[model samples]
Target: MDTNHNKSEKSFKIPGDWKEQSKQLKEKFSTLTDHDLKFEAGKEKEMLERIGNRLRKNREEVLNIIKEINLS
Candidate 1:
């Protein structure tokens, strides 16, 4: 007789105060939209890249926060 088993475990717990993080993200999006409206047509590419960088940083911040809270 032979027996074998494979198992994997993953964490699926929801982080604390996710609603506040969602609200802050929405506010940041609104602010980015407002900031984008001030740029000239000729600078669209540069402005977009800047905004994208800011958003990427914001996303990373949120992810880090979630990880800290959930993994602790």
Candidate 2:
């Protein structure tokens, strides 16, 4: 039932403290605007997809970068 797309749509739990995370992302990639990183309820995947497209990266790579943001 298109589980992969569904999965990608549901993946990535946006951080509660997203501003700091967004800041980190901006530092790493200056092209991202607040609108790109804006975390809306149930729209985490949309944001990720937009980021991946903007960065010319795949969702998995974008996901990895997002995951790494919290590590530092």
Please give me the total number of clashing residue pairs in predicted model 2: 0
For each candidate in the order shown, give its overall lDDT on alpha carbons: 0.46, 0.82
Give the residue spans of candidate 2 off by over 4 A: 1-10
Q: Candidate 1 lDDT, tens digit per residue, 1-49? A: 4343212312223345544544444464664554532344455445444
Q: 1-72, model 2: which lDDT tens digit per residue?
A: 555656534457875478898899999999988888888888777888888888889888988897899888
TM-score of each: 0.30, 0.80
Clashes counted in candidate 1 amount to 0
Q: Per model, how many backbone clashes are there?
A: 0, 0
The Cα RMSD of model 1 versus the native structure comes to: 14.8
